[model samples]
Target chain A: MNKNLYIKELKRNRKNFFVWLSIVFGFTLLVLSIFPYMSGMGEGLTALMEQIPPEIGKAMGMDEQTWSSALGFYSTYYGVYIVVLISIYTASTGAGIISKEERDRTSEFLLTRPVSRKTVFWTKIAALFSLTLIFFGLQTVLAGIGLSLVNEGTMDWGIFTRMHASGFILICFFTAIGVLISMFFTPKKNFMGMVVGLTFGTYFLNAIAKSTEATKWIGYISPFNYMEITIDPHHAFNYWGAIVLILVAIILLIVALKSYEKRDMAG
Target chain B: MLAIETINLSKLYGENRGIRNVNLKVERGEVFGFIGPNGAGKSTTIRTLLGLIHPSGGRATILGHDIVSEGVELRKKIGYLPSEVHYYDEMNSRELLEYSIGFYDNINPDEIEHLADFFELDLAKNIADLSFGNKKKCAIIQAVLHRPELLILDEPTSGLDPLMQNRFFDLLEEKHKEGTTIFFSSHILSEIQRMCDRAAVIRDGEISAIENIQDLLKKQMKKVRIVFNPDAINRNLPIGSQNEKWHDQKVNFEYVGPIESLIQWMNESKVVDVVMEEPDLETIFMNYYKR
Candidate 1:
């Protein structure tokens, strides 16, 4: 990877990184910080939970445990908001990282430099995932801190670890899809709408599948179905699913690199 | 080794457009011009050499490096100035220039300041805020920053005023003295006439002619009008003069011969006044295009 290009990519993205990071950070804290109040309501919240349909509760990834424990409460929001939001940020960034150069018509300046297209491709990828890992890591760390701060009872570290592990895999899977999608589309296209649709669309697919027995097969098409965010002690981390999703991500990235190498630098 | 050599280089976009079967050999330290109208495939050929677009067929080498397989190494010695400058709008001129030079080694950072000052460009202004001419100045600075061996310029003076154009040509002269091989592409005949040693004329994606500038000028037809003394009106018109017309003692015709012969012929006649005009390149191009 070219260090000069990698550093420039990182510096160029610094401001956008902060904006997304703050949003994810604030959302993580907000979910965790509000848990104590919900748990304190006790039977009143339980009564409120009973009034909602189980299918609706399942669709939202909520349950009785959502009002009982910090991890359970946070897991509901983690899957829907934190993971999807972070994925949207990362996936949109991945989509734009290389395509933006062409869209801005700076590829001529860049490709004319003493750097191979391969070096530029991988260097941008390296910078991209570096941002991805950092963003994922910081959010995980914040969640851990928030969980510890609010929980009056002992937190289940194993379930927390399992849930976040699946979240990381899902985030990577979506980010890779973002990169691949950008390769097929015109450089001038704004990827935000597509990225939002992808992240939310798949998340809903999994939610819909879980809520109804009839549509469970539909979830198989989505990556979210493979790596699910669950606070249940009975459900273990899907190691095979994680591996498959990681491999798919690698394949997507390689496909993106190949297409980029062959693409004409359009002004 | 030749500075650039292309063997049957072709890039066809669908059935129409793009260069075809272009073969050229540019010697080291030669100032070669590539003249064609817009959409005449000049930029297409240059982009092929730079490896911006994959060649449809054939191959080329620059500084003895294969354009396809060894583009990175070859580009190290190439300085390209595009017709339309597009830089990162977020960066000021100084930052953009610095970023550009960071890709190459053995660069003098002081050269950036020197070139910027020479072009009278303010380095602190963001690229988005700069005028088209200012951005062009920035483009020129970056192209020559590393003292590259080959300079490829495409319509390089479009946005610059005449004064900057002169300064730019002066700088190019300095670079040429240092043995830089320049591939200047433009539709402007005057610029090519001023700077080129030899030029290749491309039309409809094919090379119609490649001639030494002096030879082209010599072979071109010049419109001549001569007013003779009434007593000298009986003298014979010079050979090689065509389409002659007369109005009393004044005669007008097109001449396509050595200037010395035309002058000698004029010496034989007691002439009162003479007017000669060389047709512009567009007319010359039309002559080639017609055939």
Candidate 2:
């Protein structure tokens, strides 16, 4: 869709966008710096796990762990927080992409230009993608930098990259959902609020249902559960399930685009 | 081919109707005015023509392209200013114009610069920092600098002061002289009277009348004056009745149709003076709703 047009729109509204990215990356940097300290707690927690029921360990994906390394810290502790943060941040970004124009009443002016609605939609999506990647990459780099200076270079880059990969996947997945919501729903603020509520509620339901063997599959229903947080890439990153979710989410996004193409803008 | 034509167009939002059964033809270079009061659906008709809203029942064409089916192509030749301008808050005037011009393939940067200078709009000021009128001027420049063939303005001077509003009208006149079909919606009859050669008054999602400004004035209407003489009243004049009494003089009113009945009623030797005023757009506008 027009890259120049997308860049122009972002450049026109760069202040808020800059603020949004700064918050995302600043929070990411803060969280990354503290995660190592939190890993010390993970070590203590793993020791405590030894005294708990084995069922608890099996259920939280903490059945096996080195406890002190980044991988273990990520597996048993950081995954939940990371997924939650990614979902919220990405959804906010996506919702802002379309709904912000409506909120500001600028969509009528913007869409009246010579571009097609599909082009405008894709341009916004591209701008959001670029913004998301820039912050995600910066946070990842700062995490690496923080690790080098503070951790005596003992940090696990593989675990770090894998975690980011999962985070990125989750972000894109939610972005697609956000686009769908933008396309289908009226420019009502409550829709974003509802989506945020559902994201957290789904995770809670999945975690609560995992105790039963028949209900274990409910965890797979949430994108958060599909990212695999067991400290073993082979066991944790459920490749087949993630691919399935991604494909399904992508298909849903296509439907959203089609709906946008057919529906009249709320002019 | 005409610049814009709506073929029996109509739109309805559920049971709440917008402009219904609207049929309009604008030639290649004519300023067609759309006049209506509040909730008159003037904006609705403009939005449907701009492809911002779909025609629930009929169709509109812009420069030979169907607005609904060929919107992208049709929009390329159209410039529009919404009733309430909404712009990117962070963009200064120049940044907004540059960003807007980047979308069109045939834009000339120098023309935009000239328009900005002509409108006395500072390009370096951010839109949010500018006053609402200045922001509207920015929107107008962005809409017109590309020199679109059809200009559909919805309340184009909603925020501007009279001086700037006149300047905008001058700009519109220049565009019209250059063969741009000018179409705009307004509730202010005085402004519409000034800007348009032919205006259609819409009332309650319907076009009440389409007529030339001069034609509306020619229709015989009430003309009244207070005279100092009560006994000089011409009883033979079969027209207006006495309005009120001023001191001892009875205010005589009568039909002045064809300007002859009043002339025949007045005796040049007896009348002290004469004061004649024509019908204004306000009276014509009220008469529109009364029908």
Candidate 3:
């Protein structure tokens, strides 16, 4: 395969990349606008916490917050957002990257160029990777905007950096997962569903396993449980399960590549 | 040298049916046309050459390389316009053209512009807004802009109005004059007859016959009709074995071996009126399909 073709695809998909980024950033802005502050939120949250049933508060991660802080905000909102956003973007972009040509009937024109099929596939993957970066970067800006709306005072850049760092890892995790799902599914409408489902499905399993020591191993199954981001190093989120996630992502990408080679494109 | 050659190429789609035992050889720089009905496997054969669909049996070679195996390499030299022309709808023509630039090496942007101008295409219009014929022109511009060695067009003029259709053929003829090899498929008998130096007729997935225009006309049996007076005696009548009433008069009909026999029959039958029908490619193609 040619490397130039891959780069070319990345350049060509600029419009789609921007569209995806806009959707992600727009949602981030919505989330930021809705929740304005943690400083005053703690008292109100505490009052509500008193009335809430124990299980519901625990599920919301509210019971885990000792006091309202940026780190605590990460637990209740930003952290969860991290996993969902990554999962959604990765799965959508991954499945779409390769299958769009087939769905659009553009593969004949695209593949007929000097590029190889493998090159085209990888190029689409690279374009998605770039799109993921732009998406998260926009969200991170939206993250700052989100915070400023909630609190007028300047925030510690350290928290922002840490959160964004976890975001970077999450994006990769999504990409890898997306690639895996894209490889296995056919170019039908259900392909995107399968990819999207995998992300949510794994996250659900892990969330359920987090509460039970007996089924605790199930937490490791979901890629979402691994994305950890916080202010402090010891208590800060690290998403160290990234290693396992990355491994799985690689294996899935390989499966997708092999599947593309073996399967005939649908007429 | 043959630029493309297919030997016993067949494709089966379960019980639905597909092309079978198809053979063709298109020499370099020749404008070869594959003519067939709607479901007669014209597009199927083209798809096989492009490696979009795999052949169940036999093999096709392009520039001396197997299409399935060397498809990646061969694609660079071939430009194709699909029958149902569709493009990325979101981008305007300029943006789409800009995007395709990355896929190819060293294509002159100005040349594309010139072609667009020649074809009177509006580059700023989004594909969704363009009419079907305009969209087809876009597909054609893309296929030819790169100036590929071999252009494979599938019913490239199916949707064009007659004026545009004539213009398209003229453009194709110009492409041929440039020494570019063309292998196009079409269902329009007139267009194929006008454009191709040599054409193949495909029916029911098999090629019933391949012949040049002269030979085709020569091989067809003439239809000679003779109107005889109702009062004419029966002994001097021609060898025509059937009779039909036309304009309240008796007419003898026969598709005889030679023009001389038709003439003899007409001369002896006290013929009041006579007419002879000559065969063209359309009739020959239909007869070939019937067989």
Where is model 2 more than 4 Å wrong at Cα?
A: A12-46, A55-63, A66-68, A140-163, A190-195, A209-214, A233-237, A262-267, B222-234, B238-256, B259-273
Q: List candidate 3 segments past 4 Å from native.
A: A1-37, A41-58, A63-68, A138-167, A179-197, A230-240, B225-277
- Candidate 3 has an fnat equal to 0.48
Which wins on DockQ, candidate 1 or candidate 3?
A: 1
The residue pairs in collision within model 2 are A228-A236, B92-B126
Best to worst by TM-score, what's the order? 1, 2, 3
Of candidate 1 chain A, the 10-residue stretch with the lowest lDDT total is: A227-236
**True-vs-predicted CA distance for residue B17, candidate 1, Å:** 1.1
Of the two candidates 1 and 3, the one with more favorable TM-score, higher being better, is 1
lDDT values, one for every candidate: 0.91, 0.73, 0.71
Residue B174 deviation, candidate 3, in Å? Answer: 1.6
Instruction: Answer with 1 or 2, whichever has the higher DockQ.
Output: 1
- Index of the highest-TM-score prediction: 1
lDDT of 2: 0.73
Interface RMSD of each: 0.8, 1.7, 2.4
lDDT measured at residue B130 in model 1 versus the true structure, 0 to 100: 99
How close to the true structure is residue A266 of candidate 1, measured as C-alpha lDDT? Answer: 66
Quality of model 1 by C-alpha lDDT: 0.91
lDDT by residue (A185-231, candidate 1, tens digit) is: 99999999999999999999999998889989989998989886978
Q: Rank the candidates by DockQ, best first.
A: 1, 2, 3
lDDT of 2 by residue, A105-149 (tens): 887877788788789877877887786676667666765675556
